[model samples]
Target: MSTRITGTSHLKSENVNVWFGERHVLKDVNITFPANQVTALIGPSGCGKSTFLRTLNRMHELIPGAGFAGKILLDGTDIYDPQMDPVNVRLNIGMVFQKPNPFPTMSIKDNVLSGLRLSGRKTDDASGLLESSLRRASIWNEVKDRLGDAALSLSGGQQQRLCIARALAMNPEVLLMDEPCSALDPGSTRRIEETIVELSESMTIVIVTHNMQQAQRVADETAFFLAEDGNPGGVVEFGNTEDVFNRPVDGRTNDYVNGHFG
Candidate 1:
């Protein structure tokens, strides 16, 4: 069974901003990701949605001078504290990208076990773990017979699910996806979208997407981000998915979704 999440605020950003050298990317934005819900972050290009996503897991630290202000909390504990290791925060918050980035050298089964082994876990039910992870990713029925095949050999859609399964194998509490469908055909995108909907039943999921229709289909809540001043981006509106889509409080949101100016 998937371990029960304690329903803590899985992710919280309090007055967070990000910078790269002289450029400020994300503005003072505060948001919380609830347990077992999917939150979609939508915006135009360079709107800082992806920047905010990277900050949630401290991925910003990898870039030179990519400093951040304010606190990001996970499970009510401050993740920005010097005492907290970024690796530990990352272990609990996994990420997927726009492109299917399966380990080119690892087999599907090995890819799933990679995180567990990397974390120094031993004496686990590897086969059962593989089964559960694959099922959670909604690709067990498709790849059950080819577990030993190289992950890179799977179709684009299958590789994406395999990436999700690999993240699940680590037993993370939150999964972050950045435009996961941007690289796929329509059929593959639908399959992955279905997989995300199912996974959100057990994990907190946050996605950065340009596809308004796709966000409507899977996200429980939607957040709209707008860039202003050519420096930092901020949230323009946020609400229940239905409310944001059908009755957005801001005209910008309605215009953007209706194919007007981004």
Candidate 2:
């Protein structure tokens, strides 16, 4: 099986499949996440959008019985290789989840620095890194004078932005976000959307959302997944965002975009 896609590709999965014990969760998924751009994955509930995101950074293995076969490539390197460290893969491809899960015990500054410590990196450069990361997340000035405060003390939006800042402090080449806007208010959601668009100029982004309007707002490319038989998931359609939403090649895609199905 082909393991990598070269020529400016930031990430890819070739014939990837996932199973949880006897039940398959994902089937034969192949796609490329481009460098310095945002690729949105959208589908109805239980369609494996989040599973695909976890696979990108190798988080599917967090489940005890979960298993998968296929190569996940980051910058043309095989992330699933037997000799590769999953931790290293995750370090380079950071992730932000739907919930704002900053460490309750950590100071905001410490929250941003924690990943570096876990990855065994020095913290000397953190001041500048933290400043830049929080700035990129659009939360710098709001929390600048209170960096030592507990991350959990922030409002829901601030906590989420802090999580984004934590991810950014890693200097990741790609960022995977799973329904990041789901729990946020419109104003905060808009700021995060703007951040995604801006960060796309420097880092490859893969976001999974059920929100069609969100997909249209920021995605340069979009992939639609379908859960056939209410079981295993598969890619039903994929193409440029404009075409996927406006001139889909598949009837199911057209129906989904037109709000005919989940």
Best by lDDT: 2
lDDT (Cα, tens digit) per residue for candidate 1, span 1-262? 2232344447878999888897888888988777789999998998999989998888879988788898988888887888777888778889998898988989999988888777767645889999999998889998999999988889998899898899999888889999999999999899989989988888899999999999999999988998976868888888898899889899998887777877
Tell me the TM-score of each prediction against the true structure: 0.94, 0.95
Candidate number with greatest TM-score: 2
* Alpha carbon deviation, residue 64, candidate 1 (Å): 1.7
**Model 2 clash pairs?**
none
lDDT tens digits, residues 1-262, model 2? 1222334447989999999888899999999877898999999899898998999999999999999999898777888889777887787889999998999989999998888877778767779998999999999999999999999889898899899999999878889999999999999899999999998988899999988999999999999999978678989888899999999999989999899988
Model 1 regions more than 4 Å off: 1-9
Clashes of 2: 0
Q: What's the distance in Å from true for residue 201, model 2?
A: 0.5
Error of 2 at 83 (Å): 0.1
Instruction: Sum up the clashes in candidate 1.
Output: 0
lDDT against the true structure, per candidate, is 0.87, 0.89
- Which ranges of candidate 2 are over 4 A from the true structure? 1-9
